[model samples]
Target: MQIRLLDLLSRIKRLQEEREILRRNQALELLKTLKKEYEELVEERKKVSQVFTKSRFFKAVELQDLIRLRDSLLEWEKIAEKKLKDGYEELAKIEEELLERHKERRLFERLKEKEMWKQSEEELKRLYRELDELALLIQGQENKR
Candidate 1:
């Protein structure tokens, strides 16, 4: 019924807020990770370039380290990218759900108003009858109290 719908609406609103917070946290985390990765990549590239400059034949250990750094950087970048995309997707869904909640709230408000108006009309009619009876009683008051 209406109560159930209202409860559901509140739950949905809370969920939407929770999702928004999560999305923001994910975005911030992704940015931090990406920045760290970029800094590391820059430092590694600088070192690798220095090694290449100093000697034509790169040592196996240096080559391996360079490759490993590159691969690790790539993996971190991919993870950040995926997290960013997921954060945006969650935000979009939350927004859509919020819109739906607004629509439901509006519908509920309209229905509530209509019910209130009907009750008021009925009460006014009943009060009018009572007023008429009181007026008649006052007019023929043989013993005014």
Candidate 2:
């Protein structure tokens, strides 16, 4: 029964480690996606700026169109910036959660170790008592002889 319990505890520890790894991988993927989006936004803003500048050489109607495009790009840039900020906030929360999980798993592992040590100590004591009894029986036989 003790061996079975110990095996169960070992399995639980392994599962916890696997879960932590999965969560870490997901967080990394999210961060990568956010970074890619942020980079794209930056590129789009640069293109808009170039177009706005080149509008100076265009006719009145084309210049007006370019101005509208520039305004729209500015609004999109603001939205993208907010999304990026939110992504960072989510990443921070995930990191904190991972840290807490690690601590909890460590606590459980320590408990399991302590239990194993206690069981071993008890087994050693039992063996010593058996040996002492056998020694007494041998001494009694010798005295009788």
Candidate 3:
């Protein structure tokens, strides 16, 4: 039973590591996509600025609308960046928890193994003592004969 527990613990640890690695890979992919988005937003801001200088088509009403739209997009991008950072922190917390669980499982397995060994040893000793007593009784009966 102790050995079985050790095997179960090992399997759980392996699964934890696999989950962590997959999460890290997902984060990397998101980072790449974000980088591309950041570049595109910079280009878009430049284009909007050029509209004010290069064209009379954007007057009071149009200018306000353009500015509002740009601001909203910028806010969305900031939120996305924040989420990316928070995702890393959450993953780190999960890793720490897994480490603690692994440690606990190892300690439990060691204690169980020690208990099993002691029980087997005590049983063997008791059997040996019984055999010795029987041998002594037989020898005494033969001497009387």
RMSD of 1: 5.2
Which window of 10 residues has the lowest lDDT sum in candidate 3? Answer: 100-109
lDDT of 2 by residue, 56-90 (tens): 57888887886788788778778777877877777
**Looking at model 1, which ten-residue stretch has the lowest summed lDDT?**
1-10
How high a TM-score does candidate 1 get? 0.56
List the candidates' TM-scores in order. Answer: 0.56, 0.80, 0.57
Give Cα-based local distance difference scores for all models. 0.68, 0.76, 0.73
Of the pair 1 and 3, which is ahead by TM-score?
3
RMSD of each: 5.2, 2.5, 5.4
Error of 2 at 79 (Å): 2.0
lDDT of 1 by residue, 1-145 (tens): 5545555665666666566666556666766776676566667666766766778776899788867876776676567666656766765775666566566666665665666677789899999999999988988795575
Model 1, residue 89: C-alpha shift (Å): 0.4
lDDT preference between candidates 1 and 3, better one: 3
Total backbone collisions, model 1? 0
Model 1: which residue pairs collide?
none
Query: Order of all candidates by lDDT, from best down to worst?
Result: 2, 3, 1
Which candidate tops TM-score? 2
lDDT of 2: 0.76
lDDT of 3 by residue, 1-145 (tens): 6656666775676676667667667766776777677667767867877776788776788889888978876877687677667766766776676576657656666766776788789989999999999899999999999
Q: What's the residue-level lDDT of 17 in candidate 1?
A: 56
Q: What is the lDDT of residue 103 in candidate 1?
A: 67
